[model samples]
Target: MKLSAFADVCLRTLMLLGSRPDQLITTREIAEQIGVPYNHVAKAVLELRNRQAIEVTRGRYGGSQISARGLQLAVGTLMRDLDVRDDVVDCVSETGVACPLIAQCTLRGALRRAREAFYAELDLLRIEDLTGPASRRLLPFPVLR
Candidate 1:
């Protein structure tokens, strides 16, 4: 399943924040790092915030930060949300109808199995796993400003 660019950005931003859990990253900073429009990043950040995947702080130094809850949600979960349902059906419905050989086709059965397997694999992965040790070592230092 293909993930939307916004979703990719969201995951990347979350991972970046996860790497530096002590720092609050602003939307402009995320946009600069990802080479995307700040508005786009803002939208994705908002969506993530709405989902409780990230926390948003409002102030002169307000910024976004990934919450423990967000870190628990895996990349797969985000991808799943971004995936287009039409694409899933497109793989099985070529002409808006079930395969003609539905009664005897093993291919369809196999496709179903493949889809299940895909989701199963995703289920095993968590957001924390994507952050890796490199990010952990880069945690930001506390600042008084």
Candidate 2:
């Protein structure tokens, strides 16, 4: 399954922070490097801070950095937290339309299993995995991985 743009941004933000464990980086810097809007980065930063996945320092020299826990955070858990929508299936849509096969659909179960398997695979990864040589090469700043 393809990840939403917001989720991709969140993961990119984590990777940026993870690549530079010793220094704090600003949202604008992240946006510039990742080629996303500053406002999008800001929103992602705030969400990460709220989830305790990253720490933010507010001041003239304010910036954000990944937390220790965030570095070790399982990709599966992060995905679950960031992709908090229950409408993976058409039957689960918030819209009031009722599907005739809702009571007998095997597709729902299959989809659920597929999603679980996806998460299970993601669980094996950590933020460090994303900040490897390839990521460093792609990012604008010098990432010491």
Candidate 3:
């Protein structure tokens, strides 16, 4: 199943924050480091703040940092919460038409299970896991893991 761009941004933001737990990062800095737009990072920051996954401070010299809750949060749980996209299969036809077999198609159910399984696999790891040496390398900045 494809994740929404919003979800992708949230994950990326989380990864960056997790990488440098001691530093408070601004949206612009996060955008620059993650190679995403400032607006996008701002939006992600707002949502993450709302979710209490990260703490935000507003003012000059204000920024955000990962919350204690964030580090222990399961990756799959966060993904599931942030991944509020449509079903994996809309079972629809081209030209904005709905498929006729939607009523009885088992394919939709199967695909749903597949998506759940994917999240289940992700449940094995937490945000802390993503801040390891390898993942730290993925970040644009140097980090001590």
Top candidate, metric lDDT: 3
Tens-digit lDDT track of model 3 for 37-114: 888889999999998889998899889999988888898888898876567865667788899888888988888889
Q: What TM-score, to 2 decimals, does candidate 2 have?
A: 0.87
By TM-score rank, best first, the candidates go: 3, 2, 1
**Which candidate has the highest TM-score of all?**
3
Candidate 2 clashing pairs, residues 3+ apart or interchain: none
TM-score of 1: 0.72
* CA lDDT of each prediction against the hidden true structure: 0.73, 0.84, 0.85
User: Where is model 1 poorest over a 10-residue stretch in terms of lDDT?
Assistant: 136-145
lDDT computed for candidate 2: 0.84
Model 1 stretches astray by more than 4 angstroms: 89-113, 135-145
Worst 10 residues of 3 by lDDT: 136-145
Residue 11, model 3: lDDT of 82
lDDT, model 1: 0.73
Number of colliding residue pairs in each model:
0, 0, 0
Q: What's the CA error at residue 14 for candidate 1, in Å?
A: 1.3
